[model samples]
Target: MSASSQSEPRLLFISGSSREKSFNKKLAKLGENIADANGIKGTFADLGDYPMPIYNGDIEVNDGPPDNARKLKALMEVHTGIFIASPEYNASFSPLLKNAIDWVSHIKDGGLQVYRTRVFALGAASPGGMGGLRGLAQLRLVLENGLNALVLPDQFVVPKAMEAFDDNGHLKNKENQETFKAVIQKLARAAHVLHG
Candidate 1:
């Protein structure tokens, strides 16, 4: 890469649910820890911190995006890669996550740089057998098709999430831990190649 394009890749972790003890949140935290252990810089962001009204075109025209939307968009812009730990709502991703994406997409930019330029990885934690994989499929579709973002083909999923982590908040199963690390490392490598 040229000197101007050779920048350190940073990963941002976002949890879809805002509950204090959310399983998805724990998964995101574990992702950060794994990324750190592997020498990748990652930041964990709580979506609750960036609150915005439900998306509506009328609201957008009347007041523009809420301040929180702009802040979240800016945050996404800085990171070269993003990992979203989404909770399954029915068969889809959580409303909170969908809303955040909707608001960010309406930022009035000529190009959807935040969504288009970043490499995204999707993961989920659930007590159910599928580990929210169904929801993750939907999320990947949105990121890749709706927003024209480049997303990794592999994803980490934690099933029986309540029992997936140990006391120290690391994955309890060794295989699961390795799987998670592989996915995260792949994202880091891809981000560096694309953005560095």
Candidate 2:
């Protein structure tokens, strides 16, 4: 690929939660807007749009991964980088997100091709004091060790996420906003080097 094409990162932004007004969903949207403003190609996605059954070995053995899983995998394969706004669930990432990952990983099509080939960045928003940082830590482990994916070290968290954003959906905290932007930029840089 040409240098310019390689340098331009195509990012997939996903919110792990499926609630209509989920904090993580809004956070994902903010990330998408920031990426778009910076001239990066970013696609914001909702887990609700690609629903899959809770992963089951029996189902996999009998039927195979659900069609939604295949569709999501296809969408992910085209991107050079991914950004996930995970929701905290009992100090870990949500089951909805976990199920999706499990289903996608089960696909034998390219054998972890999507995870191995792309760079990932993680962020979270929670009403608690930790700002969903705990969930992100676990998510990082899954991406790095389980999937063997390249993930950016820096992560963004929004505490009291219900009030973290402004009316326009932008982060109200300037410092936090900058940190999120930096994380996204770092992902872009890493993806370019790896996929270029």
Off by over 4 Å in 1: 1-6
Candidate 2 per-residue lDDT over residues 1-196, each given as its tens digit: 3223555778889999999989999999999898899988888999999988888899999998899999888888767889999999988999999999989988998648788888999999999888999999999999899999988888888999888899999999899898898888888778777885
**Candidate 2: where is the Cα deviation over 4 Å?**
1-7
Whole-structure CA lDDT of model 2: 0.88
lDDT of 1 by residue, 1-196 (tens): 2221436778889999999999999999899998888888888989999999999999999999889988888777777889999999898999999999999888887227778788899999999989999999899998888999999999989989989889898988999899989999999888888876
| lDDT of every predicted structure (CA atoms) | 0.88, 0.88
Model 1 scores a C-alpha lDDT of 0.88
Clashes of 2: 0
Backbone clash numbers for all candidates listed: 0, 0
Give residue 151's lDDT in candidate 1 (0 to 100): 93
